[model samples]
Target: MSLAALINQLADEDTSALKTLSLVIDWVRPRPQETIASTLTRMEQLEAALTESLDVHLAVSSRLQSWLDNAQFFQLLSGLGLYSRRGFFKEISERLYERVNPAPADRNNVKDVLFLVFNRKGDDAWIHEVPDEALLKLLGTLWHFSPPALERTRIRVCTQILNAIEMLSIWVAAEELEPNILRLNPRVVDRESAFVALQRELAAFVQSYVRGLQDEDEIHLDHDHALVLIEQCRDEIARLQRRSVTAGSTMALTHLLERLSQTLTRIEHLLDILDPADKEKRTRRSIELFKTLVQASAERHGVRTLWRDNLRLMSRSVAENASDHGEHYIAGSRREYLAMLASGAGGGLIIAFMALIKIQILQLGLGKGVETLWVSLNYGLGFMLIHMLHCTVATKQPAMTAASIAEKVEQGEHGRANARKLAELLVRVGRTQFVAILGNVAVALTVAFAIGWCYTRLEGVPLISTNRYDYMLAGIHPWQSLALMYAAIAGVWLFVSGLVAGYFDNRAAYLDLAGRLRQHPLLRRLLPLTLREKFASYVDEHYGALISNFVFGVLLGVTGYIGYLSGLPIDIRHVAFSSADVGYAMSVFIPGVEAFAMFTGFALLIGGVNLVVSFTLALNVALRARGTRISSFPKLIRAWFQVVRENPLALLYPPADPRPEPLPDNHPHPEAAEAGQPPSDVTDSSPSTEGNR
Candidate 1:
């Protein structure tokens, strides 16, 4: 089918694509041995008659190729009459390579023509038969081909070349595209030098292509490949303007824009592919795309993870492009890409460990043991000291301040912060570090209590001996409690520490200060003025180490005191609450502390019942966090019955709703706006606004 015929079918003319396909099947597939010969004969006859009197060529090359694969050519001939549309080229290109080999000088010409044929809209009749590498190299070099100095060449030639470039991209990739088309075209090579001519234009084109792909998810990469094609056409305008500032420059740019207008149109094409009626197939495609990007080494740590391929291609193009143009290419690793992971992961783990031990020791009626605590705490602190020392020597964060963040934010134009009400899952990666810290703290408390319990039962001090069996409930002894205490302290501390280190090594943060300090303005945006801020944040994050070690020291101090002095016969209820038995004011004070920290373990026994009951005015100070000045505090307070009821991802990433990806403007929430601060506009269309765009 001709372009006109196909368009007519699309427009509901007498001929439709369905009818065209039906006709081909009826007439073409029957003859197996002589379909190609018959088609050729028919085309020759039509060409002869057309020259004599203009008439349609009654042979379809695209349909013929498709039939060649599955449908027989005879079947197509019976129904469509002579299918002569762009699809024929596509069919041919899929199955065969052009056997012809041209000389060095003619190589570019052949490739350019082939690209034009391959990019034909509607039915691709014969482009698929071309060799992949040869065709790709041809496609890569088109920017270098100089157009004829004619108005039509400016309009038709460039448009066709660009269209073809875009067309072939359906089979290629954005980042994988090569800019060597100009090299193969020879027009650029003949006139311009290797460094300052075609290479420069190729570089800029590469950047534009990559830039088009920005915000296009690498992981959820269901974006239109057609944009890559559209960009090829747009860059042609830029290429022409650079080639000749003399004439038609304005017209060329205008046409380029028109081509780009069709860019996003093909998103429908990809969506259809992803949302196929076959559910099994749809699932498979999603899985394939995810696996490819995830397992890709180019996306790993120590690599410039985000946009690395784009920059690499850009650099190559720039290197090959003209001197002035190549200067426009920018590429490097981003700064502070892994900071949040370090701070949250490192701090959370330590805190969890200490919290567990301390609470347990007190609850078990054991005084805090000092020796083991000091040893573990000291080791953790030493690591923090080293981490801080490294940051100090690096002098990074001050440079990574807001100005740097703004530049990164601009580049990440497509990413919208996932605004939502955060649950525990969002708040604490309890398993990652927060939970580890809490568990360790529990263990530490248990250890101190057990050791104290043993010391209290000793007949005498270490200088004097005592029976180890004093704590026997049945066969178990007091010394066994001390052993259990040691087990808790050593096991909890080491297990959490090692696990955190492994997580840091494996699932690194999005913006870690230490890892990212060196990469800014190159990999990430930076300001000389704010580099100091980065340094300061690094110092603050490292302080968790000091807090951790200090607690560790207290652990050892209590241990020493217990070993030396008999543990006083103390009841936790009396020490913690005081048996007024009347328990008047103590109820008020205890509930407050229990609600927040659950320190008394009574919070667990009653299940935050008292906390929920006593929640009052100050706690209700929150305004409606999101839109329309609607305050849902009462509803939210009631909802905590659920959060307090069912905690989720609390053990993974942060709990901030719209979990930020460790970049600037991380988690701007409804509370942020209510606090007299403008929330991050993720987009002008507030997600909840009535009729919001």
Candidate 2:
């Protein structure tokens, strides 16, 4: 309805206050595709119309006042804040349940009235989109039209705010006392600790504030000391988070810490809103709080948001572990670069034998299921052996190295110099990857060709039949086959395997697996003390890699079988294996030079897809988990181009005098420095030379 028409209707004595208020809201709301300026103009027009017509002004003023006076507000203050009284899992299930089956509204509660008035599904979207200045104007108009809230109502609201503070303090204290939190910070058990003192101070403040409210004397209460205590509690929470990096963290502990943090923040907001002086500031704070409550109510039933909110802490923990492991994958100096090449050569040698075994198994003429099982075991066991021998699979480096690069990007300061440093780091990563791939492809091809020649000479038959050779060539054909697509699939598995490795690493730390192994009675009885210690130490360091390699192999092996069962095209192609296949095919029958070049070009393309896909995926997750953004991307790209222009060979090979990159001042892992140990980047570790595949 038009503003004039709404004003005329509201001026009529027979129009109910509720219906009149609803009409005004409908008029003030933004129309579809309407600009915020247009909405603001309409709002001003409505306010002007009410000003001119005394009857309409009186109608809106009296009705809104009555509504405010009658509605209960405690639930609005305590319940609508971003918190829950239930446990994390229970809250998640309840939110999901409520999305499917909403509860009946409470007519007397202001919280319910908000949902009634903003009944549209996307009301929160527009409300959130509105600028703060526009919202303040709206609030000013409402305050001008409606009478001031009664003294009794003001007292009641203050009481509710105090009650909320009390409840939040209790929740924070209880969460802080959880066993996991105590393990992280045992000082929480002391009576003098911030967690305990916060509860005591809040109680005293409540009693004093309430007594002053009742007496109506000059109220003089300072919450600054209480705020200080809260800050200390927050520091303790931060300490717990830092300690969790080395001590390890579980989902339950993460959830508890997140809840405690939220509760403390809510308490702070309540205390700010409850100040008896500074009436104007209090009104502004209240309006801001109301907006927050509305937004929370709109999203209360969102399952995806709930899940994301709950998993954020745990994801960070896992990513932290992955980042630690990823540091070993980046080669900083010429020596490390050579070590990577040697590792790749070792892995390629093993992969050649694995490829031969796979071909022999295919020749068995077994059923699809049985063949898949044998191939999976061959790949899994081969990868595990490669890891044990400190070998490297060229394709697997991208997923791990990408995380290391992200850490650098995250730590970098925002400037041209930082961007240049990052670009230099990228150069190191690229050259390391290049040498590894070269080693893998060269060694695998050479070994496979020798094996095929030796077998044919001894047995008087070609190792690969002509028919099998054609099929293998066709499978790797760039345009004619799904080789690139299969390589992309393999890339995704590679990223998932990195996550699996991170998870097991976290599990090992959280469960104290090394400690358990060292103390196990069976190990003590079965082996000498030195052997047992060595075994436990080895397992602690290599457990995640061993498990990840096996799992990655299984995933690769099962894709084609899954495709066969479902009648779809699904498979994996690794560059090293494809190179071996090419060698075997050449041994069976020589192809033309063009065909051979085409085969090599497509093999490189497959490797490119594998690297790009996994690196992109892993880098995206690592950045998000760290809550870091490379806002200087354009500058970073420019820096990278400048480096390439200045020295193109730097990207393909290390410089003659390679130096180790120093750790940044704000390195994410500070525990090592604190322990008087060199940073992981500066020290060449055993894992640095091992296979990360």
Extract clashing residue pairs from model 2: none
Model 1 Cα lDDT, one tens digit per residue, 335-409: 121233334344334333343343334335443454435434543454354344331101111111211222222
How far off is residue 469 in model 2, in Å? 1.0
Query: In terms of lDDT, which candidate is strongest?
Result: 2
- Lowest summed lDDT across 10 adjacent residues in model 2 is found at 684-693
- TM-scores for all candidates: the values are 0.21, 0.86
Off by over 4 Å in 2: 8-25, 81-89, 145-155, 211-219, 274-288, 311-314, 405-425, 590-594, 627-632, 655-693
